[model samples]
Target: MDRWVCRREKRRLAIDQENHLGYRRFYNVMWYCFRQRGSILSISNSSGAKSEQRKGKGSDRVVAVLERMGAERIYGVPGEEILDIMESLRKSKKIKFVPTRTEWGAALMAATEGRLTGRPGVSLATCGPGALNFPNGAEYAHLGGFPLVMIAGQKPINSSLHGHFQVSPLVSVMEGLTKYAVQIGSVQMIRPVFSEAFRIAQEEKQGPVSVVIPEDIAAEECEEDEL
Candidate 1:
């Protein structure tokens, strides 16, 4: 019995050490990305070259609306469905995209930022599996009363063809977990839907919200006023 007890204690100590190391690594990464630069968000853009200056487009409006709502950074892992949105973020000076290794980590980081800053922290993910990874952290944000906004890119809404491989009812899946959840059907809905989501996330008893923007909707053309 004494030997068994000693072994258990040793195991516990090993687990604690592992956790401490993980936390120390995360903190070091955060220091390099934000604190050392005096910016809440990292200034680095994924594309090595500067993004061309753009006045107005569907994607541009999405970025503009997010900036106007006072979002400084968004965390995400980039994927094809979300490429246009990432491009918009890259072009915008007002908001920075903080890339992460996984969707779950992005969601957790955003939630932590939201909790600390008293604003809705934004997380982005691609459709299907990419978005499926978010619920773990998203549910935590909801239960903890963190103001988090989960923005997911969806498969093209226009396709009626077979093999809508990555397509799933994301809005339906997220509805139960988030205070506000919706799928964007057009460029016109982008601004109002996200604006309402921001309001809901920041209101009393704050929690998480989910917005699913379809690929075609993001690719669609738009005048600035439409958003």
Candidate 2:
């Protein structure tokens, strides 16, 4: 009986020592993180630095052009493929991102807005299945002759890793639905591409226009404020 008690006490002591060591290690890690808090906060919390970094980016130029054209609202669902553009929208003073539950619902709203305002109403969709849901509203705009702009995000232009993912020849599918459908290939093309699209959407027999931006192109450096 005494031998068993001695063994139990030794096991208890070993467990306690192990727990104490674990606590010390956790405390040390936390202290290190606390020491790094200042630098981490400087990078993450500095809005000015972030704003400066965004000033001449391709995504920012797109935002600037849209805002200059009096675009105020964007309707759609958010996804990983379009995060840079989405972030640009968040930073813009004139444009606002309007979140919706369904892609078709957002397209419908954009269609209504365009019909009422006589300008291109903008809606967004991420690549693959998200963009596929847009045909309902695209068809609606086509039938009603309302000006609508559909901006679809796509994978990096050169990526071959999307076999099971969202990558596809999206512009081809959107071509039949949109009056103008084009994929942006570079930062310098942002202005011309969107200008032509907006113009076409407002022309006689106006309908939906589609613009696809690859992830890499959106991250490129913009040479001008407006295009």
Q: Say which candidate scores most in lDDT.
A: 1
Clashing pairs in 1: none
Give the TM-score comparing model 2 with the true structure, all chains together.
Answer: 0.74
Tens digit of lDDT per residue, candidate 2, span 63-168?
A: 8878877899999999988888899899888888999998889899999999999999999988888888888999999999999999988888766644648677
Per-prediction RMSD in angstroms?
Answer: 24.4, 13.0
- Please give the range of 10 consecutive residues that has the lowest summed lDDT in model 1: 46-55
Prediction 1 global C-alpha lDDT? 0.88
Best by TM-score: 1
lDDT of 1 by residue, 134-160 (tens): 888789899999999999999887887
lDDT, each prediction: 0.88, 0.87
- Deviating ranges (above 4 Å) for candidate 1: 1-55
